[model samples]
Target chain A: MDNLKTKHFTFQLKDLEISVELIEELARIDDSMPEYSRFLKEEIDSTLSLSQIEGGYTILPAQLDQNTIHIGDHCFNVGKSIANKFTNSTHIAIFTCTTGPLISDRLKELNSQGLILEAYLIDLLGSVMVEKAMDKLQAIIEAECTSKGVNITNRYSPGYMNWDVKEQKDLFAFLPENFCGIKLNESCLMTPVKSVSGFIGIGEKVRFIKHACQSCNSTNCLYRNSKNHC
Target chain B: MEKLFEQLAYCIEFGKINKQSPYPPNMKDQEGAGELTGQLLDQGVSADDILQKALIVGMERVGVKFRENKVFVPQVLMSAKAMDAAMIQLKPHFANNPGSQKGTFIIGTVEGDLHDIGKNLVSMMVEGNGYEVIDLGTNVKAEVFIEAAEKNPKAVIGLSALLTTTMNNMEKITIAIKKHNKNTTVCVGGAPVNQEFCERIGADNYSPDPQGTVEFLNRTVA
Candidate 1:
């Protein structure tokens, strides 16, 4: 029974260099805002610290419920809206990428001292850095899995498409303890405020689907119009 | 004197905080909003004119950019910071005389939602636009919002929630505010909130961005 196992991945800071463009995108600045670039560069050089952690699971044969999927000795009531995405999927990968606690702590300090704007901006940069780290992680997975002749789908996280946030505990259980020093509190929020957790689907025919913002129930998300990011 | 106000407005619009700030490369080492405000006051520009003519103009411009997605969080933040530094000098003037502020605003992220990024941005934008923003910080309960509104009877209350779960509390808070006093204008916004959610909760309105919130509040008191 223990032979059914999960693969883990960790990344070094230097291996993940968050690009200026990504930070700018996260900041939501479409124009060439020179000042934002200046501040972001300073933040990346001084305040930013990235740690990437990911875990993958090869699905075990199991049946699906109207709102639940039984796979690999675990069952997730992933809701009908999200289960629709998994119809043709064979395996699912769960991962978390964080900018570590350093940036989050610093943001709080900035906020308390009345540096609300600067703090909020840096917080956006942290999110972008974490996203870049995830990209690198996905690349590593794709390189290894390509030889296996399997296709990977875009990542989906909880709190979207009726996949309740409480299901985060089920997702985390498949990974190593305190994987990359990330933890979920009572609120299902990751310890590092900039951290993200999500699942990716793999199948022979699954290609990356363009995120359909309209299809998503959360119609008012700021990032919905810029759907490529998710 | 007019030139000084113009300079102050420009400094704030571009997020030139002070002479010491090195962010906006074009304005590096130049007198920013902070220094220009002090100089304008020293030259006898009234606090009301400085706020109405300089700071409000800058904030309104940034607000429009934010709504259009031309300026992101960082740019708005820089402008907010410059506005804050300038406000440090103007606070004393308003303290000595009443009615200097256009209105009072109380804002917070709803309970169980630790996210404050959105709330902070709105608070800064509202404050920059000549309102007195009382930020209750993140994870605020309905009672806290109600109490604050009670203390400042005419204050406009804003509730923010980034989490879908926490958005439920916004509805509760709005009902409590209306119950406490029907006239209080309670506005709501966040990633999970929309116009439908806003109206369902009986809130006065909803804004997608900070500038939109400022515009809504401006119209309410105008």
Candidate 2:
């Protein structure tokens, strides 16, 4: 605990150059539908203009005993799916990232105005942006670990892969109060709506798996359905 | 009249809102659902016919395409918008003829869940299919659903929850609705919900997509 350090990062909209191609693939639109493709591009630009991305992670010494991950004095029952992936992990990076509240506020406004299509496109863009920001954060963590000759595993969130979402409380305990300006409600849902939080394993024996969807049983997962595009 | 209905259905399927709507570039400058519906009404076609013969046909095609993965959310939303444009012209008729709807549907996201995109999509699809929809919005409680069900005695109740944690709330809501009225039909859906969870919670049905829900309602109520 004495050597553990928390690092925070703020990214401008320019930092996350979310590609239009990726957005189209996720939204299932293509150049053939030029009208919708153009609409999505416009909304993406507007959403990015309103987005304020922020993220941070705190690396802590961890010990895995079966399905339980012991970090400091807290133990997270992160379920078998995640525990199996982190079996060789010697440390864990707890992270949180958000695309601020403006995009959500704009979505509400669009919905109120009966622009459901535009609002839906913006919502999809927000999801893509926040995940892109997390990807950037992960790259930073990876580079730092690479410098130290430590490998990282694929990130896991509390709500996915059969892991009990209630463990979000335990996961948040590793971060400072309101880390990245994200707050968990009683139901463990993050506010600002487009925020994401999770853990990434760090150690020499840990390995990053590109597609965890094959082993995961949560078939209705949005990420699983869009992982190819992601 | 049949030609007009076919044209209107095509407009709804391709998402042509009006003569000015630039979608489905091939249909550009042609009168869309908005114009065609108005013409049908002025030509003495019944609102019920427009809904039954045109709007529902168009929406059903879109729903099937969505189920088959030939179309996605944005495309479906465009179709919904076109449906809305046509439905707007028939609003007065529906108001005067309350029994014109196929049936009533009550839907909401369970308590502790604020996600509504999936719920909204379901609502649009159901409404487009001629059901009178009563949307309870997000973070709705069991009592609210029971109350709405009590008012619309024959309405089918639909519960949605996007979070694994709120899946418990969906179960609690389902149990409460069933306890209030043992005969009431309850349908549950969401990203985290499935057939097993639906059966475990005693929910009457589970649909992975909006089309399945529409098909279930068609089978159950029709």
Candidate 3:
């Protein structure tokens, strides 16, 4: 039964709108010949698949006694390792807030076309990965709250509906190594192409509702926000 | 007649484009939608009869398959491409009759989102369903959408975003459009977007796939 459940949990790579041009560019970045375009096409032809088990999930496995929780040993240890690799590490700060950096230069690019590249499917893939990772983390955190007999609120992250992006630093500070394998570049991006760090509020006042993309202030939200709720 | 329609629908369902266009591995050098459609036209079939009876019938099946994940993007893209090939030959008749299209649809990726594969797929599907789609390209701002909506009052608006960061921008634009014209129906989509986001932002509709979007537009216009 458990084996069947695990197999059922396997998720196909959800559609990440990829352009023919970007596939070509990715091929170039790999230093493959232009004929490699055919290879890229073939890969695109074959949809990408990812699973929750591959994403990895862990329970908080403990309880928080206070509303204002600080980055303690385990989370700090993980975050510290992440911070060390980032440039301009001194200015990198962490906080506990709802809003974080939702948009950044890390998402946009400049090219010879004189037009800024507005979005990338790779970025979308990363966003989807982060969202699924967050879901796994939420499962763990929620379980912790339930085991402790506390009603938790929504998993709020920086750059949420009304939350400001500036609070990303605070969220980073709370996590271990700013997230195990994820790093914040000078421009404030979590690397590894697949990672997320956010906090789930544990209280009675936390709004529990279906995630709605239209309700959020971030209209152009790409990560699994309210967009997936419906 | 039903047998002929079935073959044409099969050609479209499996993405058989013509006698020469090779794809799908199984249907090499087979008669595609193009030839079948042409043959139907030469048989004194009304343009509307062929479109409604044959082309749209197959596409609706394709749409349902796409929605159920029975097919993926590449297959759908191929189907859309094949649909376009057939439409090219049918377009002249539509040119003769201006009322052929159900309505106009304006689509784009909201500002901060450069992704267009979703928008393009929707455009192709909507076009396949015989609606004229004015693709505004990507990274479009609220004002651009408002302007386009004002210009094409009959057209449905579609906004797409492929990044979580840009999802916020989709909301802002949706709000801005409603503020300008409350009646404008904005359809929100993308991999991350769902119906929940649509209601939250006050958009009229949300679709997980191109087929749903077409159905929404069809129901609205119907």
Candidate 4:
């Protein structure tokens, strides 16, 4: 079974917003949490999901540096090095989000399980949306790069080591409303539970970012986020 | 009858937590696992019978589906939720009945990583399979795991990483756990980890999904 499937959805990015009740609900969950340390996480997750629906984080296609470039802001940047490496190279990535209305229903059902369910659904929604957005962004990048005689290599994003996350501000500088409503918190993270920031490299040579799998060093990085396999 | 068990498994597998849950609309308003399990218990079915015979069976199937990508997080979360709801009614039976657990399992998202969906899924699956789970939560340090292992001397450890960057911490924590207790079994999973990476980190096992983890734990305890 392939965990990765090609999902296409056309969503109106402007329709997303932060839900105040979600924050309160998350806070209520926090107060009852068995583990105090995880309180902040529960709250952040709730806030992120609400933010994602509010439409703050987004990506766009633009002509950058004589290349068809994909730009994202207020979304997740895995690392700085990965982001820089993409900028210096060429690859095609599709930037899109889940375009269906089933998210609210899905989230509602998940919420019945517990507050953590709400937070999780929101996070999953954000990630799924980001993945979908990336797919759309990839198609645009590929079409643009192909016409320019540049074969795409691979995709990369910010938040990786060596790629300053502070650039999140700069990455969104060109977009109106900071690229679809996703704004930087004080720490430079997207407010929406599901958002991402990155770029796709388009070039003639095949340059897969060495950061994925064992070839990359994730353990040593100070800015590491999410204890996940991917 | 076996039909009820089949229906119960479908509820757990599709994530039909209860009648009120609106997901997977086909099951909407139907008798959910909560009601069914409660009904089964009220009918004099042993709690152990329900757990091993129904809840565990349902959860195990979903875990494999999740690992194989036949189902995604949303679907699996529903299954876990269904299993959890059913477990709430069966906790007393677990306590009343001894020698039911496979063993203790300590799980957490590695240090510097904050994601918990994958880890939580594993926790529910392990718990559903009759293992006592100590979930350390996310952003856990190597020392935290070691501390847990020290407390539960017979416990096995599972490490989860969602980001490429955080996967690095898996090795460090594995090394630390092994350093303190060489006998400690370490298993790793997440989007970026695999068996090859597991061996490279010197961890004892790597399972692609929660069911795999359950099977491994069962073997060890057996």
Evaluated with lDDT, which candidate comes out highest?
A: 2
Pairs that clash in candidate 2: none
- Candidate number with the higher TM-score (2 or 3): 2
lDDT of 4 by residue, A42-84 (tens): 5334433343332222223333343223443333333444544
lDDT of 4 by residue, B1-222 (tens): 567777877778777878887656777789889988888888888877787778778888888876675665545666777888888998888788756666889999987666667788889889877778999987789999999999999889999987656677899889988988888899999876889999998998898778888999888874
Q: Write down the C-alpha DockQ for each prediction.
A: 0.34, 0.61, 0.02, 0.03
Question: Where does model 2 exceed 4 Å of error?
Answer: A1-4, A34-47, A218-230
Better of 2 and 4 by DockQ: 2
iRMS of each prediction: 3.5, 1.7, 10.0, 11.5
Q: Which candidate would rank higher by lDDT, 1 or 2?
A: 2
Indicate the fraction of true inter-chain contacts that candidate 3 also forms.
0.00
Q: How big is the positional error of residue B81 in model 1, measured in Å on the Cα after superposition? A: 2.5
Tens digit of per-residue lDDT, candidate 3, span A30-143: 221112345434434552322222222222322232222333342222232122222121111221211112222333331122121123333443454445545544555556
As a whole number from 0 to 100, the lDDT of residue A9 in candidate 1 is 62
| Real contacts recovered, all predictions | 0.41, 0.59, 0.00, 0.03
Q: What TM-score do all the candidates reach, one by one?
A: 0.82, 0.93, 0.56, 0.60
The better candidate by lDDT, 1 or 4, is 1
What are the lDDT scores of the predictions, listed in order? 0.77, 0.88, 0.59, 0.63
Q: Which ten residues in a row have the lowest lDDT in candidate 2 chain B?
A: B20-29
Looking at model 1, residue A47 earns an lDDT score of: 55
Report the lDDT tens digits of candidate 1 across residue range B35-99: 89989898898898999999999888998987886766768878988898899999999998768
Which TM-score value belongs to model 4?
A: 0.60
> Each candidate's chain A: what TM-score?
0.80, 0.90, 0.46, 0.48
Model 3 C-alpha lDDT per residue in residues B82-129, reported as the tens digit of each score: 676678778889889968778989999988666666787788788777
User: In terms of lDDT, which candidate is stronger, 1 or 3?
Assistant: 1
